[model samples]
Target: MRRLLVGLIVAVLTVTGLLALRAELMTVEVEQPEGSYTEVLVAADVVRENADVRAEMTHGLVSTCRLLVNADVVEQSFRAVGDGVFAFRLRPGLDEFDRRELRGCLSDLRVQHLRVHVRHLQTVTPADDDRRRDGTPAAGRR
Candidate 1:
């Protein structure tokens, strides 16, 4: 009985050690706040698709942009602009701050070949009483 208990403890310790070795986790702090926002248009390119390059780049950029901008994806299209060229329209929760963060993030993006590159960043100001795709008034003033 004592041997069985010792074996169980060893197994538990092994599992715990493996868990500790896993990827680091992001530390969550205060919730992302929302404020007046402008639409941000971003462009990138996928020079190649061999070895799932397109899919990998799309997922990676979307993830990083989300982290930096705290924006909702208004729209995204792969190869919509041209072959291997991608476009994304993000509506950030915060106005100027998110815009700066997104621009900064895109500027910081870099890789050697077949890498996602932020070719453009544009801030689109909506007219008063702007409507969404569903034709309803956007979050701010109506």
Candidate 2:
């Protein structure tokens, strides 16, 4: 009976290992795009203060820049409305880094309207045909 139990345990362990391997193999790997997403460090300059704040951002790709805050995995992309003004679509995962960056802007102008300027840009290329075949914008491509 002891021998039978040991054999069963070994068999279960082996099956589990095989299942893990299979799972790992099933995962799809995505390569970083050539210019899909670019990381840009921005400094917000506040120009006015009120119920709604207004600020301007200075960056190369002001129209398609997202801010990753605190390394928390949450990113907010700003849409350029006009002149240095941008619209931020609020999303989850706001990290300490984002808060710190915003704070820096507020301190500079004492308001939420921050003028952002990108200091660093990380550009990636677009995804492959398979991703676009299904009409998917590729991971983080949009």
- List where candidate 1 sits over 4 angstroms from the true fold: 1-52, 75-79, 109-114, 128-142
TM-score of each: 0.44, 0.23
The Cα error of candidate 2 at residue 95, in Å, is 17
Candidate 2: RMSD to truth: 14.0
Task: Evaluate all candidate structures by whole-model CA lDDT and list the values in order.
Answer: 0.52, 0.42
Model 2 spans with C-alpha error above 4 angstroms: 1-36, 39-79, 82-125, 128-134
Per candidate, the number of residue pairs that clash is: 0, 16
**Which one wins on TM-score?**
1
Q: Which pairs clash inside model 1?
A: none
